[model samples]
Target chain A: MLRSESEAELAFRREVRGWFERELPAELRDLTFRPLPDMVMPWYRKLSRQGWIAPHWPRAFGGMDASPVEQVILMEEAARIGAPEIPTQGLNQIGPILQRFGSDAQKEFHLPRILNGDAIWCQGYSEPGAGSDLASLRTAGSVEGDDVVVTGHKIWTTWGHHADWMYALVRTNKDVPKREGISFILIDMKSSGVLRRPIRTLADEFEFCEVFLDKVRVPRANIVGELNRGWTVATALLSQERLILGSPGNALRAYERLRRLARALGTRLSDSDKLMIAKARIELETLIASFLDAAEGFRDGRPVDSSYLKILSTETTQFILDAAQTVSGAYAGVKFPMDVDGTTIDFSELFLQSRRLSIYGGSNEIQRDLIARNVLAMPRGRA
Target chain B: MSEIAGDQMLISDNVRRLFDASRALPRARAAAACWPDTDRTVLREFIEMGWLSLLLPEDDGGMGASAIDFVALIESLGDLLLPEPVGPMLATVSLLAACQSPAADRLLKAALGDERIVLAATEADRSLQGDTNHIVFDAHWADVVVFATGETEQFSLRAVAKIDVDGLDALVRNIDGGSLCSVRLDGSMGEELASGARARDIFMRCRNMQRLAAAASLLGLVRKSLQDAIDYVKLRRQFGVAVGSFQALQHRAATLHVACQSARALLYEAARTVGTANEAVACAAAKVKAADTAMAVVKESVQFHGAIGFSDEADVALFFRRAVALTAAYGTAEACHRTCFAG
Candidate 1:
C-alpha cells in the first residue's frame, strides 16, 4: 500500500514550489485578489515559453508530460502562489482536442504555433438558437472542392476578438440527426468574411464576442476527425473542456478574497460563516480526491469520466460565490468608478462573473442531465 | 509531487479483498442479532494479516503503520459490518504508543491474539471528561487494564475484576448514554504508568483515534447502504418501471452519494491528522459529519426499500439500526461542536 509521497516526489514538489515563488510575476499574485487589466497575456506567454503551458501534455507536443499526480502538485502550487489565469482556450481546449483527433499536417502546423504563443484560439460553439442545444446548430459548412464555405452566426465566443483562430461545430448534413451531421472545423479569424462584434455582460465588460461567418473559407485539412461524425469529436472536446472549466483555482481565489473582504468589513465570524467555511474546505478536499480519481483513471489507461467532476465543480463554485456575496452584503455591489490600482474593489464584478461560470462550458443544467444520463445511466425523460 | 510508496496500496488492496470476501457472510441475520459477535476465525484472520498491529511499533512485533493505514483498515471493516471491538483495541494501542511506557511493548504483544482490551472512556453523565469509575471488560481476556482518573492528570493501572456485561448485550443500546463500570477501587491502585498532562494527552489522543476510526467505519456503512439502495432500485420493478428509472428516486440516491463521498473524504482527512495536537478538532468535525451522513443515508435506504426495509429481517433496517447506534457513539454531534469550539 502506498503510504505518503516518496522522497523523490517531495523533492520535485519543493523544486516546483521554489521556482513558482521565485519566478511567478508579482502582478499575477495581486490579480488573484483583484482583477488586473486583461493584458496579462504577456506573462502567460512567458510560462508557455518556459514549456509549462500544458503540464500534462505529451512531450512530443512540446509539453512536460508530467504525471497526473505531478500535474496535481503543479496546479496546487500554482494556485497557492496565485499564478495568473492563462487565457487557455488554446492550451486547455483546442490544443488537447487537436492532439487527440487532428490530422498530422494540422498538428504540424498549429502545435508549434500554440507552443510558441504565436496562435491564440477561441471557441465558436454556442449560437443564438443553439446555446444549450448546441447540436441543433444552424451553422453551415458546405464542401467547396478545396475549401469549405462556412456561413454561420456564433454567439458568446469568449475572447473572440483577440483570438487568431476559431474552432467551431457546424452542420454539414441537413437531413441527418442533429448530432450526427455536425462537423468540427477550424477557421482563421482573420479571414475576410469573419466579423466580430463584442457583447457587454452584467459585469459591464465586453469579454465575449458574437462572430458572423459570411462565406468564410476554411481549408478541407482544417476539419477535425471525419465529416458528419463531429459529434463524437465535439463531445470528447467538451469533456476535456468541462474538466478545464471545473478547475479549483477560481473558487479558491474567490474564497480568499471573501475572507479578506470579511475582515475588511469587520464582520464577526459567525457560527454559520464558520460552518460554511468548514464546508467549503471539506468540499475542496473532496473535489481534490475526486479529481485525483479521474486523473488516475486516465493515467491507468481507463476512460476518464467527467460527470462527477462537472457536477461537483460547477455547483461548488456557485455555492462558494453565493456564500461570498452573502458575506460581503452591501459592499459586494460597490462599483469601481475607474481602473484604480487597489483603492476601489469591485465585488459586483465577481458576482456577475460567477453567474457566467454555471452557464459557460455547458450550462450546469446540461451538466446535470449529462451526469444523469451518462454516469448514472438514467433513462431519458419522456418528451 | 510526491509519489506514494507502493506499500500503502498493497495493504489497501489486501484489506479490500478481505472486506469483499467477508461481505458474503450472512450480514442481515447477523446484524439483526442483539449482540452479533464477530466469528473467532475472522478475528484470527485479521490478526494473522497484521491488521491489529498496524499502529504498534515494529519493535513491539507490529507493522508501525501510520494512522492513515489504520483508517483504510477501519473503512474496510466498516464496509463489511464486521462486529469487532477494532476501534476500542486500536484506541488502546494508540494510547500505549503515545505513552511509550515499557509495559506498552509487552502489552501490545499480548494484544495481538486472543487478548481483548476495550477503553473505558464513557461515563454515566456522558461527559467527555474521564472518570475514575473505569470498567474493564473480561479481565481474564485482557492482560492489562489502562484507566484514567477524573483529575485529568493521572492514569492508574490495577489488577481488578472485569465486569461481566455478557448478558447486558455486546452492542450497547444507547451508545451515547452508556457507562462502562467495573468494581470500584480505592486509593492509588496497582501500578502508575504515566500521569499529569502527559497522561491526559495520551488519553485524549486515544479518544481522538477512536473517534476518527468510528467515523471512517460510518463512512463505509454509508457507502454500503447507498450502494445497496442503488442496486435494489435498479432491479426491483414498480408500476412497470424499474424503481431506479424514476427521477425522484435517482435524485435521492445521487444526493446520498454526494453526502457519503463528502463524509468519506472528511473522515479520511481527519484520520490522517490523528494523534497530532490538531486531532481533537479534526476528529470532532469528522465524527459529526460522518455520523450524521451515515444515519441519514441508512434511514433513506430503509425508506427507499418500502415495507421490506422497515422489517428487522431486512438488511437495510439492520444497517439503519447500526448507523443510528454508531452516531451516538464516540460523541454526539453537539458534543463534537463543543470540542471544535473549545480551542
Candidate 2:
C-alpha cells in the first residue's frame, strides 16, 4: 500500500529484478523447499558477485551497504521473481555479529568468504533442552590447551550438513545462571569428531540437520564475546533474527503457492475454497504492511515491537500454507507435483515445511509470552 | 506509512484539545446513555468545525479534503468516544456532492451549512422492518434519510420522521449513545436520486465511506483502549510493584499496540484506495483488519483491567462496548471476509 519507494531504492529494485531475470538459472528460478547446495549456492554466489549478496553489510565488508528500504526492495524483488532466499548464516547471522564482536583477524578471515559463498555458515544455538529456553543450553565447551573442546548435540541446524563453519553458543561454566557461563564461538565444521546427521521433515526436506560434537576442538581465538556471556550475543542477535523471521517472505511464498494451487484446482475448487484462497491473499497483504512497518522501525533504530511481527508473520504464513492445502484438497496428499487441469502445483512438501516457521525463530507461543512480559509489562505469572 | 499531512495534523490537534477540554471520558459516558442517536449540539459543533464539509469538493463550498484527512477527523471522534453520527452525515454529503441534481445539491450545501442532518443506510441487509421501514443509523435526528433498494438497484430518500426508536448497542452509537431508529422507506416516502448504473456508483461510494469511517473509528478506539490499558497497568500495582513491570502483561499489551498500529496503517492504505471498483477488495481487507484488531484491543483492555473492566463504571468498558458495536457497523466482519475471499 505504501507506494513509491525512494528513487534509489526503486532503482535498486530494478537492478535486482534485472539481475534475477537475466542471470538466475532457469531450473533454479525457484529452487524452493530443500534445494541441494549445488542448485542454489552457485547462483547465490553469482548474486554475491553482483554485490547483491548481503545488502545489510557495510560496503567495506563487500556489501552494498543498502539502506533498510533498499534491503526490503531486494528481498521483495527477489521474492516477486520467484528467486529462492540465499542461505544466511554468514550474511545474516554471524556476519553482523562478527563485525560487532569478532577480532579484526576473524572478520577479515570470514567476511569475504561469506560474501563470495566460499563458506556457508550454519548456526549452532539450540540443543535438546535449549530450543526455547536457550539459556539452559548444555552444549559444553571445556578448556583444552589452545582450544576449547566442544561436546553436545545441536538440533534444527539448517543446512548443517552442507555448512563449512558453525557459529555456536557453548556452555563454558555450569555454576552460574544460565545466561552467564556461555560463550559464542565459531568452529570449522570439518574439525575432527564433528558429525552432522540430516533430519527429514514432514515435507521430506533434508534442509535441517542434527550436529554432534564429540569433543571437537575449536581454537580459543574463535570465541566472539566474553567466555561466559553468549547470551549477550544472543540478545544482540534477536533484533536481526526477528527482522528476518518477521519478514513477509514466508507468508508471501505461501500465498504464491496457494495462488498456483487454486489455479490448478480450477473447477475442482468450490466457492468456499476460492474464498479461503482470497483470505490468504488478504492475510498476506496485512503481513506485508506489518513487516514494512517493522523494517522502518529497525531502520530508525526504534525500539522494535518484534514479537508481534514474529507471531503475525509466522502464523499468517501457516494460515496461507493451510489454505494451500485446502485449495489442493485431496491433491494435497499426493507425492509429486502434477498438472491439475492446466496448472502444475504441489502442496504437501511446502505446506509441511512451512509449519517449521512458527516452531522455529522462537515459537509464536513463546513470542506471545515475550510480548506480554517485555512489551506489555504484564505481571509474570509464576508456575 | 507516510506521515499525516500538516493540515491534517493541525485538525487532529484541534480535536485533541477539544477532547482535553471536554473531559472526553465523562462526555463519552453521558453520550452513551442516549446511544447511536446524537445531540444536535454535538453535530453542530462538528459541522461548525467544517468536519461535515471536509470531504466535499471545494466547489461544493467545502474543504476538498482527502479521504485520509477525513480518517484523521473520524478517528479523533472515535478516540473521544463521542456518540455523534458523523459517518452517515459525511457519507450523505460526500455522495450528494458527486451526484448531478439541483435539489440534492441544495440539500448537500445546506448540510455543509449544518442546517440539515442526513442519515444514509448503515446496515447490510436490505429487508425492511415491519413491511414499511427498517432502523437506519442516526435516523432519530436525521433531516433526511436515504437508502438503496438492493433488489431494484435504485436510490431513495425520505424526510426524517423523528420517531421513537431504541438502539440495540450492536450497530450504532459506538462513541456517543443514542437510539438508532427504523425509518419507513416504502410507500413512496422520498425522492430517487439515481437508478441503474448511476445508483450503483452512488451506492458504492457511500458504502466505502461508511465502511472506511467505521474502520477509522475503530482505529481510534483501538488506540484509546490500548493506551488506557498501558496507563492502567503502569499505575495498578500487585505484589508491592507496578503490574506493568511484569513481562507477561507487557507482551500482551505490546501485541495489542502492534495490532492497533498495523490496523491504522491499513486504514490509511484503504483510504487511499477507497473509491475504485478495482480497489474494493483492498478496502474490504482494511476494514476487516481494523474491525478484528479493534475488537481484540478492547477485549484485552477489559482483561488487563481485571474486575473493574467488566463493570459499567470503568470507561474502558465503554470503549469496549464501542469497539464491539463498531466492529459490526457499516459491514460486519463476516460481510468483510466475504468481500475479501468470496469472488
lDDT (Cα, tens digit) per residue for candidate 2, span A232-339: 987788766887777776676667677777666667778789678767877777777767666776777766777778888887888888887877766778777666
Q: Which ten residues in a row have the lowest lDDT in candidate 2 chain B?
A: B161-170
TM-score of model 2 (CA atoms):
0.84
Model 2 off-target regions past 4 Å? A1-23, A29-32, A55-60, A64-81, A142-147, A173-176, A225-229, B1-10, B16-36, B56-65, B96-105, B122-136, B145-206, B226-258, B272-278, B300-310
TM-scores for every candidate against the unseen true structure: 0.80, 0.84
User: What clash count goes with each model?
Assistant: 8, 29
RMSD of each: 5.6, 4.6
For model 2, how does the per-residue alpha-carbon lDDT over B1-343 read when each residue is reduced to its tens digit? 5455687778777756754636767876766554433446556766788867778778867788887788777776677766566766787788877766766677777777887777776544443345544656645567666666644444443233233223322243334464454444552545666566776677677777888888888887778778888889888988888777766776677667667766776677677665544356666787888888888888888898999999889988888877776676677666777777653
State residue A257's C-alpha deviation in candidate 2, in Å. 1.4
Give the DockQ of candidate 2.
0.36
Q: Write the per-residue lDDT of candidate 1 for residues B245-342, one digit (tens) a residue.
A: 77677666666665665566556656665655567777777787788789889888988888998876667765676677677766666567666645
